[model samples]
Structure formats: structure tokens, C-alpha cells
Target: MKKKKEPLKYHIFQNITFLLKCIRREHPLLLIFIIMQVILSVISPVFGIYIPKITLDLVMGSADTAQIFLVLGGFGIVMVLSMALSGMANEGKYIMYNDMRRYYQMELFLQSLSCDYKNVESEEGQTKYQRAMSTLRNGDWSGTSIMIVSSIDIVVSLLCFFIYSGIMSSLSPYMVLLLIVLSLISLFGTRQAQSYEYKQNDLTAAYEKKLSYVIRTGSNAAFGKDMRLYHAGGWFQELRSSLIEESAKLAGKIQDRYFASGVVNAFVLFLRDGIAYSYLIYAVSAGQITIPEFTLYFGAVTAFSGFVNGIVNNLNELNGANLQMNSMRAFLDNTNDPEPETPLALSDLKEYSIEFCDVCFSYGTDTGFVLDHFNLKINAGEKIALVGVNGAGKTTVVKLLCGFYKPDSGIILIGGQDINNFRKKDLLKLYAAVFQDIYIPPFTAAENVSMQELKTTDRNRVEECLVKTGLWEQFCGQPTGIDTPMTKEITGGIVLSGGQQQKLLMARALYKDAPILILDEPTAALDPIAESRTYEQFHEIASDKTAVYISHRLASTRFCDKIAFLSNGKITEEGTHDELMQKGGAYSQMFALQSQYYQNKEVAAAYAEA
Candidate 1:
């Protein structure tokens, strides 16, 4: 379904209200500081225009020397005081802006972390996420800080416009009207330029996202070996160059529009100043107005033109800032399925039996179902192996069971209750999983195992899990023992082998000690014998927990109580290893082929060694 577009006024009001609430919550005094800065800024310039006129008029009139000195002294003192106050207010505003910018950035980060996992994985969702992140990262160009500053500019400019209009009217209302007309023409041109830039925002964001991806991938040490071995650096460079050239072309188009707007503004200013100055000079020479009055009116006319331009420019900037705010709000609002008003508590459940009934799921409307009418049941404390080839929906099944993705139809039940009944966070607490991909953060070994800070971690539990996973002796032999950092990027840190990293993940899962344990190809990095040994060790450690193991190595399924072979989005074969072999089906054939391949390889290695 298409979303209805919001009006410009609605976007402006809603974003402003949201930001004001943020300011109030984060720093209430910031608003006062901003207002103080604006008022002083406006007043200081007014004094600059009027004080000279007053001083000149006093000199030319019959005013005595003492009176002239008094006037000059008061003007100097007021100017100094205004400058000092403005400085203080500006300094305070700057500090507050930095604080608010950090607060807003953190809010965006938190929102990204908490949003639905499906959204994180989807293309449209990633685009929105990148756009929001890019908008916030460009602190001076767009986001909360720019929006707040642009809003203040509009208010200040409007205030100046009204004050200057009153001054200009004193000379002639016709002059004020002429200035307004010329300013409006310039404003129209500038607004056109701004609109063009606004329309290109999505394209610009796409380019930025691509450029960021290239830079990130190129710089990551993890990809360094692949790039070198495959000689792919030139390919990456060419891709980056192409993107940069295209982005530069787009930027050139935007700059051309701005340049045209500038030309129009310059022409309008030329006409306005020529007409105002010529009329004022004629009036003074004709003895209709005094020189002091001419000076005052001329100053007011020039300043009035500036005030008009300020209003136009600030309004354009405000609109741009509001557009970026809308992007961020859209991303933050893209939430997953709403939880029920009263979600079932995980603590109320005793047994952790899992069941999937007539379930169907697909990644998108255009994609075929990865799982269709898939039904499975695992009694409490039972161990099952789900064996399937790549893209056979084994991982999808695990993801659905873990509530990372919801099925399009049918139900997944846990302990006889619908999985949807539990809150996502609470549902996740019932299972501990180690998947194929591993990410070990640059933290101490103990922190990595426990997935907690040093202060809060149970040292004994972490040690116990490490020992069970066969990593305790290796860690203890290191200089820093379990306190050693896990990444080479950190000074005095050590990088683990792929096999060791897999073990670390296993330790993490064991530390959680949930009722259900899942290992999805988690031992892929280990040799076949080592992988089998690790699986056996994990089985012993999680003996009482309901276990689900997924692997293509059929030999490993021997230890499982039951083995279900998946094919074309359904379980096609199910039985113990001996039973499946005796049935002489697809599972039996695949297992025989794998066994023969491994045996031949072992013979070939032995012959080569001899």
C-alpha cells in the first residue's frame, strides 16, 4: 500500500514539536540561550545603523561639544555591552548545540538497534537506515542541530524584516513595496534551486551509501586477504571512481542552479540600491530632507534589503532541514509487528517443547516460499538434526523458530502457546544459538564468552564454558590469560584462528544456558573429525537442553536421536541413521556419496605422503 504524503506545514510543525521536546528533555536552558543570542544579534545591527545617524545629526546641529561627547560615550558603552552579551549567548548556544547533536545521534543509533531484524535485512529498510545515518552524520548540513538553527534564523530574520519595514515606510510606503516585490522575485528563483536540490536528495543519499560501502569494504582487514589473492583492488578502485564521477556530476548540476539563483539576487540588489540611493540623493539636494535624514533612510533601505534576503534564505534552509528530519522520523517509525497489549511472560512457561504447524514463509512477494507447509515437533530434552543443502531453508527454519522472521501463514508454538504471544526479547531468552557466521568484538576473551562487561560477568561461569568448549587451556597460556582482547586492531591483542572463534561462540551459547540449544553449521571452520568432536562435546554440555543441529555432514547425524532431511522446502526423509540407510532414499544416497568422497580423499592423502 502507498503511504500518503504529508503537507509541508505538517512536517514542519511535527518535526519542530518533536525537536522542542527533545531540547526540553535534554537541555531546557538551550532554548533560552538561543533566543538571547537571536535578540542580541538583531539589536546589535540596529544600533550599528541608528547610532551613526544620531551621532552625525548631533554634530551637524547646534548641539554643544559636551552633549556630543555624552552621546558618543553612551553609544560606545552600549556597543561594547551588546558585543559582550552576544558573545556569551553565542558560546552557550554552541555548547548546547553540540550536546543536542550528540543526544540526537545516540537516539538514531538506539532506534536502529531496536528496530525489527527483518527491516535491517530488507533493501528498502537498509536504504532508509543509511539515509537517516548520513543525514545525522552531516551535523552542519542537516539533522536536529541544523533544523534548530534554521528555525531560529527564520524567527530572527522575520523580526528584522518587520522592524526594517517600519523604518523604510517612514521614507515612503512605495519604496517598501518596491523592495518587497524585488525580494520576492529573488526568493522565487532561490526557492526553485532549493526545490531542485530537495528532489535529488534520494539520489544523493544512494550515492553516499554506495560510496560508504566501498570505502568500508576496501578498508576492512577481513577483506584484505581476499582482495590481494584475487587481485580485485583494481576492480574496487574502478567502481569507486565511477561512483565519484557520477556524484560529482550530480553536485555540478546542483551548484549550477545555486549559481543562477545568486545571479538573480545580485541583479535584484543592483536595481534596488540604485533606485533607493538615487531618490534619497535627489531629495537631499532639493532641500526636501536634511542630510542626517538622508543618511538614516539610506541605511534603513540597505538593511531592509538584507533583512528581506535573510528571510528568504532562512526559509529555504528551514525547508531543507525539515525534509531531512522527515527521513529520520520515517526510519524510526518503521517498526515490526506491534506486541499484544498483554504479552505472555516467558517465566510462566515450564516446558520448552517446540512445534511448527503448517507454516509458510517467503522473503518477499516476488520470491518463492523458502518454507511451505513445514511441520515439525521437538519434545522437551530431545535432540534433532535438520540436514539440508544450501538454500534448502534450514537457516530460514531456525530464523523463524527464533522469531527473527514471522511466517506468512500458520503458527509456531512454544510450550503449547503461540510464539507471537511472547514479547520478542522474552521469546529470545528461551533459546541459545550459534550460527555459521561469527563476529567476535574487540573485547577481553572473558567478555566475549560471557557477552557482558567485566564488572557484571560471572567469572566462574565464563571459565566453566571456556573449559567445556576446550578453549580454557589455550586462553590461560596467553600472556593476559582470559583478559586478552580478541582483535589484532587493539594493541596487545591476539586474533583467534577460525576454529577458535567458532569455539568462542559455542562458549557464549553455553554461558546463556537456555532450555533450547541450536548449532547451525557453527563448526564449519573445523576439520571433519574436529567438527564431529566439537558437536559431541556440545551435546554432552547441553544434555538436558532441547538441541537442534543443522549440518550437511551426514556422519554427524549419527549422534542425533532423529534426523530430518529437508528438500524443496519440506522434510522429505526422517529417521535414525540406520533406519535412513536401510530405507535407501535420498538421505541414504547423499550420506553414502559423502562417506565415499571422504574415504577417497583420505586414501589419496596417504598415497601422496608415501
Candidate 2:
């Protein structure tokens, strides 16, 4: 069977559409502000160009002094008004940029969370995800500003250029052709440079991914100590330098291209101005133009060049912004997952029976089945233990029961209803889980134990769960009590030991009071006494609920009412502890070996005492 490819690459125009949708939908205020800035941009440059021409007429005294003063005054008034309007427009732009940044930051955070667990493991998807994240943080508003301003500049510049072109055309039709050729050449050359930048980005993608990983591993607090203790800082530094060199090589390729093209562009600009100058000289010498007209013509030419240059620069920036906008839009476009739309909201979760019939699952198309032809029927209130060696598919069974992954072929029923028919939210509410790996939340010890939002936390319930988990006296009642944060970053807060952290995770699960409880190696790191205490507490509070215990420890299997022994992808043994021992199968062999090792230890201690 072939695996389906992920829709990861977003089309360029599709990205633009995404940006527009985001601004229109999520940031309505900012979108309005952007529109205002665009209007000001269109008005401001034209005002500046025309005002200067009017001022020149006044300075040359070619018209009535009173009329000239009035015209000059009008130009001054418009200039002042334009400056004030632009200042207000710029303020709006700042607000709009900041708002857009905040909005996208939130969107990116939500998007990261919504991604499927397997997506994070995909090298390509993860790379793209991280780039999207980085750009979201550093380039959100900066990119938006570039896009909006560049778009506005392009529109304004073209309008100003046409205004000058109209006047120049009246004087000489050839001058309009000269202006069009120069404008096209300059704009086309810059667009080529922008396109090169996009290609350079693609070429250095692998190098940048390596650099990001090296930097993150070196600097993250979780890995920092390990990196320093292992003396890996120098190694990471070398890796980063290599990535930098690779990036530089790619950049150099693009820079060489740009420089070659820029020289030709510079020559084009010079030739265009030279021709315009020749026309001016001919007009003045033939008495077709006055001193004032010559001055006006020179001013118009300079203004036209400035306007066209502005448009070229802005258009180049617009191209780059389009690329970034495209990726962001693609991510946002699929915010809704392909999962069932009418998610079942769980109610009546007090029932505690579970069943799996002909259950089959595989990690992906390339992977073999983790569980095949699996059948299990667990009665209400039964405490079952799953015992397995490494790669025995015990954990996969738990994940399947929890609805994290759907089976490729099979039916799982809860209270005689197919599990798939249950809404995801409802399914989650049915069970409380403590996995093999612990999660230490960045919160107060109370909130960590309760696993509830701080604003509405039940403090007493947190205290009770901590005590029941056997960690309250040793951890929660420290200098700051339960109010103390769990992180080791600050003083007056105690950090839990590995066993204590495990106990805290158990406490969090206990607080949920779900109908079903799952504990997967929850006491692996605990001492014998702590392990016994946890199991006893687990039996007390979770007695009426269906409990699933997954562990490698054979001794713990004895506590459950029934044990399912898994070997490879199948359950090979199912019985009570005594039954499994009497059968002398895989579970019996492991149990005997473990019992003999401890008995031998006792005998060795006795011999030492003698």
C-alpha cells in the first residue's frame, strides 16, 4: 500500500489570498488602518512633486507676484496638510503592524498545537513548521509593513509618473516613449533580483535547517547542561559555522548575478536622463521654453525618476513578502483537520467496560502491524495489567484505547458502542492517563498536581491528590507550600525528584476522577516503598473504575485481577498471576527469573551476615 503525500507546499497567489483573508477576518481594524495608509501614500508623493513645480514658478517671477504668492501659499498649505495626514497615517500603520504581529503569533501557536503527532516526526513537515514559526515571530509585522507599503508605493509612483508623463507628452511625444522604456528596464531588472532571492532561499533551505537545529540544541535549557557536560559546545559551533559557510556560498551566487544586472540598470538610467537633458537644451535654445519652463521641465524629470525608482524598490520587496505570506497562508488554510466534524461530547462516562475485536493497526504504509487480529473483552471494574518485553505492542494498545490513533482494521466498543462513533472530546473525558514519559508543566505545584487551569483551580482537591499520591508531605509542604512554582528557575520553590515527578503525574490523573484510568510505567523510577504506596493508593481511589496498567515489572502484575502478556504483536497469555505461573509460558519464565534473582540476593545477604 502506498502512503498519501501531505499537502505542504502553498501556491504563491494562494498565499496572497490567505494574507488577505487573515487581515480581513482576524484583523479587521488593522486592515482598515492599512487601507488608510495606502490612501495617504497615494496622495502624499503626488502632492510633493506638484508643489515643487508650483514653487518654482513663484521663485522665477514669470507670473503676477500676488498670484504667485497665492499659488505658493496653496502649495505650502497642501504640503503641511499632507505631512500631518501622513504622520497620522504612519501612526495607524504602526498600530496595524503591531496588531497583525500579535494576531499571527497567536495563530502560529494554535497551528503548532493542532498539528498531528506524526506530523512532528516528518523531517520535511517539521522543517517547514519551524520556518513558519520563525517567520511568524520575526517577520510578521515587518513582512506586512513591507507588503502594504510596497503595494502603496507602487500605486502612488505609477500615478505620479503618469501625471509627469502627461505634461511631458504635450511637449514631446518621444519623451513619453523614453520614460516608458527606462521605467520598464529598471522595474524588470529589480524583479529579476527579487526572483533570485527566492531561488537562493530554496537552495539554502537544508543549510538553514541544520543551522536552526544546532542553535536550538546548543541554547535550549533542557539540553544546555547535557551539551556542556558532554563538551559538545565546540562541536555544535563547528556545525553552525559549516552551515553559515554553505549559506554564504548560496548568497554569493545570487549576489554575483545581482551585481552584473545592476551595472546594466545603472547605464540605462544614465542614458535615459542624457536624452531628456538633450531635449531640454534644444527647447531652451529654440526659445520654445522660458527660464521658468526649463526649470519646471528639469524638476519634472527629476521627480519622475524618483517616482519610478521608488516603484522599482517597492515591487522588489512585494515579491519577497509574497513568498512569506504564501507559507503562512497555507498553514492557516488547513486549520480545520480531516477528523469527524460532529465531535461527540462525552456524557454518562460512569460505565467502565471496554472491548476490542479483530483490531489491526500499523504505524504507516512502510511499517508492519503493531497489533494484528487482537481481541480483548474487559469487564466493568476489572483491574487489568499488560506485561510485555520491549516492542511487545503494549503501549500501542493503550494509545488505541485512548483514541490517539484509529485502527486500520477493527472495531473497539465502549459500553457496546463503537469507539469511533464517540466524539473525540467525549472519548478523552472518559479516561485519565499517566504515560511512561512524565510531563512537568510550568506552573505551581498545586496546578501541576491538579492539571487544572489556575484561574479556576480547586486548591483543596490539589492538596488531597498530592497527599494521596504520597508527595504532599515531601514536596507540596516546602517553604512556599503548594503555591510554589514547579520550575527550578526561581528560589523559594522546591523541584521534585524523578520519582516525585512521576507521583505528581499520577496525582494529576487521580484528580480527573474519570471512569477509566491508565498508568503506563508510572512507578518505574520509584523506590520499593514508594511503588507499594502508589499501587495501594491506586487500588483505593480507582477501585470502582476500570484500570489498565502497563509495565515491564512482573511483580506489579500480581496486583491486578487479570494480566495480558504480549509477545511481539500478539497477546500470547491471558490469566491471573497464579494461572500465568502455572502455565509456564513467556510470563512464567520472566516471573521465575525475576523471583530467583531477588531470592539469590537474600541468600547472599545472609551469607555475608554469617
Candidate 3:
């Protein structure tokens, strides 16, 4: 279904209201400071226009020296007060603007974290996320920051326009009307230029996204080996240069439009000032107005031009900001699937029996189904081995069981209830899954294992898990023991070897101690002997829980209560290891092939020894 496009005014009002509400909730005093700043900014110009006229009129009339000094003193005092108050207001707004920037940045971060996992994995969702981040990271030019200033400027400029128009009307209403008409013409040209610039925003965002990717990939330490060996630095540099050139070209085009608008504005200003000067001079020569009135009216006319220009420029800025705000709002509003109104509590069940009944799913509409009519069941507390060749949708089954995704058709049940009946977060509590991609943050070993803050974590529990994974003695040698940072990114941190890192993840899963434990090729980094030992140890540790293990090595499946061989998104074979081997099916053939390879190496080693 296509979303309806909202009107410009609707976005303008909605975004402004939204920001104002945020300010009110977070920092209400900023509203007062903004109002103060606007009033002082507008009134300062009023003094510039009127004070000169008053001084000149007093001098021309030969007024008393004391009276003139008093008028000058009053002007000086007002100017000083305005400057001081304006300075304070500027400082307050600056501080609050930075605060709000950080506030909104975190809001964007949280939105990304809490949004649906599917959205995080999709290209369209990633693009929206990047756009939102880019819009907010623009500092003063960001939608949130500039909207406040632009809103205030709009109010200030409109107020000045009205006040200056009234002053100009005292001389002649026709002059005021002529200036407005010329200003409107200039405004029309400026709006067109702004529209053209806005049209290029998508191209600009794409270039920025590509440039950021290139920079990040080129600078990553993990890619250093490949880059140096393959001589790929030049390739990255060339890509970066190409993106920079494209971005520069886009910026140049936008500037060209603004340049054309400026030229048109200059011409209009020339006509506007020329006509006003000619009329004012005629009035002065005919003695229709005094010199003091001439000075006041001329100042009013010039100031009015500025007022009109301020209104036009700020309006354009506000409109541009509105577009960026729309992007930010869209990203923040990308929510997860709705939870059931009265969600079933997964914790209420003492045991969980997982089932995938006629489930069909694919990552995207264009892709073929990774799991088509897949059906499987694991009784409570049973240890199952899910083994399959690469791309056989083994991982997809685990992901579906864990509620990371919903099937396109059919249902998944846990504890004999539909999994969708439970809230997503509640469902997640049932599983402790260690996936293929390993990530241990640059935090203390204990913090990494516990997945909690160092201060709040149970050190004893972390120690126990580390001992169970056989990493306690290794970590105890470090300067901070288990409190040692996990990655070298931190000061005085120690980097873990591949096998040790795999052990650390196993320790983390053990620490979670959920009812359902999943190990997906968890021993891939270890030697064959060590892998076998670790699997046996983990099997003992997980004896009380329902566990699912995935490994390509059929040797690891001997201890599992049941072995399910997945092929073409279905279980092609299932039974105990002995039963499957006796059947001499695909599982048996694959196991024999692996066994023969190891046997060949052993025989070759023996002959070499003789």
C-alpha cells in the first residue's frame, strides 16, 4: 500500500509542534530565552532606526544641551541593556541547543536499537537510519537546532516588517506597497532556488553514505591485512575521491542556483532603493518634509528591505529543515510489530516444547523460500542436533524459533501455544543462543560474560561460568584478572585468541542460563580434539536444559538424543546417531566421507614414522 503524501503546511506545523513539545518537556526555560532573544533582536533595530531621527530633530530645533544629553543617555542605556540581555539569551540558547542535540541523537540511537530486527536487516531501513543520523549530526544546520533559530527569526522579521511598514505609511502608504511588491518578487525567485536545492538532497545523502562507508572500511584495522596484501589502498582512495567529486558537483549546482537568486535580489534591491530615494528627494526639495523626517523615512525604507529579506531567507531555511525533520521522524517512527494486547507470559510454562508447523519463510519477496513447509519438534529437555550443509536454512530455523523473524505463512508454537502470543522481549528470554558471528565489546571480561555493567554484575557467577568454559586460569594471569578488558581497544586490555574468544562466548551463554541453549558451530575455532572435549563438557553443563546443537562434524552428534539432518529446507533424516548410521542414508555417507579423510591423514603419518 502506498502512503499518502502530506501537504507542506502539514509537515511544517507538525514538525514545529513536535519540537516545541520536546523543548517544553525537556527544558521549558529555553522557551523564555527564545522569546527574550527575539524581542531584543527586533527592538535593537527599532532603536537604530528611530534614535538617529530623534537626535537630529533635537539638534535642529536648538533644544537645550541638558535635554539632548538626557536623550542620548537614554539611548545608550537601552542599547546596553539590550546587548547584555541578548548576550545572556544567546548563551542560554546555545547551551540548550547542544543539550537538545544530544537528547535527539540518543533518541535516534534508541529508535534504531528497539525497532524491528527485520528493519535493521533490510536495505531500505538502513538507508532511512543513515539519513536520520546524517540530518542530526549536521550540528547547527541540523533540523532540530536550526528549526528553533529559524522559527524565532521568522517571528522577529514579521514583527519588524509590520512596525517598519507602519512607520513608512506615515510618509506614504504607496511607498510601503511598492517596496512589498518588489520584496515579493525577490522572494519568489529565492523560493524557486530553494526548491531546486532541496530536490538534490537524496543524491547528496547517497554520496555521503558511500563516502562514509569507504572511509570506515579503509580505516578498519581488521581489514589492514587484506588491504596491504592486495594493494587495495589505491582502490579505496580512488573510490573516496570519486565520491568527493560527485558531492562537490552537487554542492556547486546548489550554489549556482543560490547565486542566480542573489543576482535577481540585487537587481530588485537596486530598483527598490532607487525609486524610494527619488521620491524622498522630491519631497525634500519641495519642502514637503523636514530633514529629520527625511532621515527617519529613508532609514525606515532601508530597514524594511532587510525585514522582507529576513522573512524570505528564514522561511526558506525553515522549509529545508522541515524536509530533514520529516526524514528524522520517519526513522524514529519505524516501529516493531504490535504486541498482543494481553500477552501470554512465557515464564508461566515450566517446560518449553518447540515446534515449526508448516512454516514458510524467505528473507525478501524476490528471494526463494529458505524454509518451505518446514516442520520439526523437540520435546522438553531433549538435546537435538540440527546438522545440514551450508545454506540449508539451519540458522534460519534457529532464528525463527527465537522470534527474530516471523514466518511468511504458518505458525511456530512453544509450550503448545503460538509463539506470537508472547511479547517479543518475553519470548527472547527463553533462549541463550551463540551465533556464528562473534562480537565481544571492549569491556571487562566479567562485563562481557555477564552482559551487564561491571558494578551490577555478580562476579562469582562470572567466575563460575569462566571456570566451566576453562578460561578462568588463563584470565587469572592477566593484570586485572577477570576484570581485564576483553579487547585491546581499551587501555591495558588483552586481546583473546580465536579459540579463547569462542570459549568466552560459550561462557557468556552459560552465564545467561536460559531454559533453551543453542550452539551453532560454537567449536569451529578449536582443534578437533579440543572441540570434542568442549562439546562433551557443554553437554554435561546443559543437561538440565533443552539444547540444540549445530555442527558439520558428525562426530559431535554421537551424544545428542536425536539428530535431524536438514536438506532442501526439510528434515531428510532423523534419529539417534547409531540409527542414522545404520540406515546408510545421506547423513551416513557424509559421516563416512569425513571419517575417511581423517583416517587417511593418520595412516600417512604412521608410514612416515616407520
Candidate 4:
């Protein structure tokens, strides 16, 4: 769905408030820039037009050389000072522009980082984030840094226009009148052109996302095997070309509209200039005005038109930039999932029992129920094995318990208090979750284990956990040891195999050492022998802590206190392996089928013995 852009009034207030806040930071430097602009604006016509006009009049008369030299020298001095002031302002503008842009860019990123986690997971939120990022990257820094400095230009331009227009009005009131009317016409045209360009940002961003993925996946070494084996390079190339062509077509249309408006505006100014010059020449020839008057009036005419155009153009550009800037503001202003204003804090974590009573849930942007009327409860220090085939809502229970999502109906309680009553940050202190999808950061092994920066990590604990989990044996012989980087994303870093990566993540979870632990297929990538070793280590480590284990290998569940067998989003059996085996339900049937291969091997051995 397309997002509706906010009104112009909203953008105007947002831009002014934002710029003022940024300006309040470095008023001294920005003030100097403004003063320079004012000085130059007042002096530009005096040197280039007014002083010269006075000297020319004296030269044309029956006058002495002393009078002429005096005026000429005044003009020369003003000329040098004006040029130097203009140079200073231009140099200052370039530096301040970059610094302010960087400031706002960082602010935008920080806002995104602190936004509601659940919102980040939603499709609409992701789309807004992408558009907001495009605004920052696209060089249209209106309503933020660029707008701050550009405001000074617009204000000064209007001030100069008024000063120059006053001079023109003295010569002829019609001169000022005609230019103002032309500026009005140009304003309408520019506004229309900018409106189209503003909407084009979204279209361009969408196409760019697709085009970038195609290029990245087609060329990345990670996808190299699939690209060649499937022979999908041609397909990627074709899709990339189509996206590029469509994006270019949309961009080309915007450029064409802008070019047309520019040409029309240029002609209008030329016509205005042509008429003023022609009218003044007639006056000079008819003796209604002198050569001196003609010279001053001609200069005034050109300067007059410039002021009009400058005011209109800056306003147009600022308004256009306002659209993109508002997008960035929208993303920042979006609050996270609604919750209590003042939340209750948790007590000492003696018992971390969890119960999900008649919970129902579906993803925010999706319609299908991942968990429907699901209910499960566990006492403190109970080792429950959650076993199910794929798509049986095993992992959903863990997600709800961790409060990653809230149930659409019913309640969850932790330590006999409603889970929702505790704040999100406080509630998360309860569990250490190791999921099927793991994020391996590019950092030293110690920092990855402790999940802290290098300085704050406890070396002794890091060493002990690594040793406990077999990761230390790999690192012990290296120069970096615990400091060794984990992923190849960093220089001097090494890549770990699938099993090593999984083990490293497991070590991180172990290091957290929270009261309750949830592990989903923690040994999925390990060999059977390695898997058995990890299972034994996990049980020993989690002996006292409440733990939930999920694995496709039913043989691993034999060690749990009780196995909760899930089928079609409900617990079909709750008992020990021996009890389930005797009952001969779905769990027993699946277990027997899985053991068939091992049983066949034993029969072959018996026949060979005979």
C-alpha cells in the first residue's frame, strides 16, 4: 500500500523546528555566514552598477580628471572587498554543508536503531525505513541540514531583490511591477515540476532495491555455486535489465518535465529583459532620460529580474525537498507497539516459571494463524523437550514466552505475574534463546561470547565457556586466542564451518547464563557423535536452569524429564519415552519409523552371522 504524504503545513513546522534546533548548536559560525551574505548582498550592486553609473556621468560631462579618478577608485575598492567577502561565504558554505549533513545522517540512524523492534519486523515499517534511508542518501537534504543553510540564501535573496527593485522603481515603477508578475508565473511552473519529482523518489527506490539484489546475488561468492549449477545468470541478467529500463524510463520522464519548465522560464526572463532594454533605449534617444540615467536603469533592470527569479526558485526547491524530509520524519516519529506508560518491574529471579493460557496469534502483516489457541505451561527447573515435525508451532511457544510477540487473546505469566505487566526490557531478562537462524557478528571471539565490547569482557569467564564448549581448543594455539575474529567480514578474520558457527552461537547463549534457556535445533549441523557430545554438555550446563529443547532427532529427547509431542498445533502426548512407546501414538509411530533404518542394519548383521 502507498503511504500518504503529510500536508504542507506539517512539513513547514517540522522543517523550521528541525533547522532551528541544528542552528542552535553552532550559532557563531552560521551567524558569520549570514553576516557575510548580507554584506555582499548590499555591496554587489553598489560596486558593479551604482558606483560605475556615477563615474560614467562625471566622465560624460565637462569635468576634471580628479573627479573621474575619485569615483573610479571608490568603485575599485568596493569591487575587491565584495569579491573577497563572496569568496569567504562560498568556502564556509561548502564545509558547513558537509558537517551538518553528517550530523543529521547519524541522527536518522540512531532513531532507526531505537525504534520498536516489532515495528522493524513488520512489512510496512520496513518499507518506510527503506524510503527514509533513500531520502538521506539521495542528496535531497531539505528540512534538515541543507535546508538550514539554504534558508539563509533564500532570505538574503529576497532582501537583495527588495533593495534592487526599489532602485528600479525610482527609474520606472513598471520595471518592478513586470518582474514580480513574471516571478509568480515561474513559481506555479516550478511547483508543478517538483511535485512530480517528489513522487518519483519512491518508484526509484523500489526499482533500485530489486536491481541491487540481482547484482549482489548474481556476483556474490556465497551464491556462486547456485548461480552456475542452476545456470540462472541469464535469468538474473534479464530481470536486472527490465528493472533498470523501467526505472530509467520513469527518471527520464521527470527530467523531461523539468527541462520543459526550465526552457519556458528562461524565455520569459529573456522577454522581460528585452522589453526593459528596448523601452529604456527609446527614452535615452527621446531625451526623456540621459546616457547616465540609461546606464543605471539598464543595470537595475537585469539585477531586478535576478532577484525575482532567485526568490521563486529557492522556495520551489525547498518545498520539493520538504516532501522527502517529511518521509524521514515519519519514520522517526513512528512509535513502537503500544504498551503501558509506567510498567511494573520484576522481582528477584528465584523461580522463572512460564504459562501460556489460551494464547492465539498471527503475524502483523500476515493472515494465517501461526499459533491458534495454543496453551502450554512449565514449572521452574523443569527440563521439557518440545518435539514436533516442521510447522507444528514448537518454536512459536518459545517466541511468545520471550515476548517477541504478544498473544491476540489470553495471557502469559512469569513468576506468577502477568508477562505484559512487566516492561519489555525487564521481561527479556528471563531467557537466553538460541534459535535455528543465528546471527554471527564479525568481532573477536571474546566479545562475541560475552556480547560486550572488548574492554568490558571478562576474560576468565570467556576462556572457561570456550573451554567448556570445545571452542577453546580451536583458539588456544592461535596468537589472537580469545581475541581472534570470528567472521571473514573483518580483516584478519577467519570463517568457521557450519558446525563451528553453531557451536560458537551456543557458547554465546551459554555465556548469558540466564535462569531459563530455550534452544532450537542447537546441534542441527553437527555429526551424530558431535551432536551427542553437545547434548550431554547442554544438559550438564542446564541441570539447574529451566530449559526447553527442540530438535528433529527424537532420539535426543530420551534424556528429558518429559517429552511434549506437538502435532497440528496442539500437544498430542505428554509423557516419558517408555510411556509414549507403550501407548503407540503418533510420537511412537514416528519414532519407530525413524528407527527402521537402524533395525534393518541389525537384521543384516544377524543374517551374515548365520
Which pairs of residues have clashing backbones in candidate 2?
344-423, 346-426
* Model 1 agreement with the true structure over 1-610: per-residue lDDT tens digits: 9444444433776898999999999899998888787888788778878887898888988899999999888988988998999899877787787888788778878887898888888888989888877777775675677788878877777788788888878878998899889888888888899888877877888898899899999988889999999999999999899999999999999999999999998999899889988988988999978877887888888888778877777777777788788788878788787886899998878898889999999999999999989988888888899998889999999999989999999999998889999999998998899998788999999999888899999988988989888888878888888889998877779998989899999999999999999999877888666676696787786699888999877776678889999888889898888899899999988876776664577754432221
lDDT of each: 0.85, 0.76, 0.87, 0.77
TM-scores, in order shown? 0.93, 0.85, 0.92, 0.89
* Residue 350 lDDT in candidate 2: 45
TM-score of 1: 0.93
Question: Between prediction 3 and prediction 4, which has the larger lDDT?
Answer: 3
User: By how many angstroms RMSD does model 4 differ from the true structure?
Assistant: 3.9
Error of 4 at 448 (Å): 1.2
lDDT of 3 by residue, 1-610 (tens): 9454444433777898999999999999998999899989988999998988999999988899999999999998999999899999998798898899898989999998898888887877888898888888878889888888898988999999999998989889999899889988988888888787767767787898899989999998878989999999999999999999999999999999999999999999899989999999999999999999999988888888888878877888888888888888888888788998899987678678788899999998899999988888999889999998999999999989988889999899887889899999999899987888787789899999999998889999999999988889888888888989877777879888778888899999999999899999888888766686687777877798888999887777777899999988788899998899899999989887767675577753432221
Could you tell me how far off, in angstroms, the CA of residue 414 lies in candidate 3 after the best superposition? 1.0
Best by TM-score: 1
- Return the lDDT, model 4, position 361: 78
lDDT of 2 by residue, 1-610 (tens): 9454333365434555656777788667766766666666666656655666666666665687788878878867877786787788777766666677788868877876776544554565566665565565654345555666676677777877788787777778888788767877977887787677765554566677888788987888768888889998899889899889989988898887788778878988898888888889899999998766776677777777777777776777777777666555555544332556654445644466899898999888898998988888788899999988888788889888977777899998887777777766677788998998776876888788767677788888888888888888875447778888878777776677889999888888888988899999988999979988988988997789898998877777677899999876778899998898899899989876766665577763432221
lDDT, model 1: 0.85
**Least well predicted 10-residue stretch by lDDT in candidate 2:** 601-610
Ranking of models by lDDT: 3, 1, 4, 2
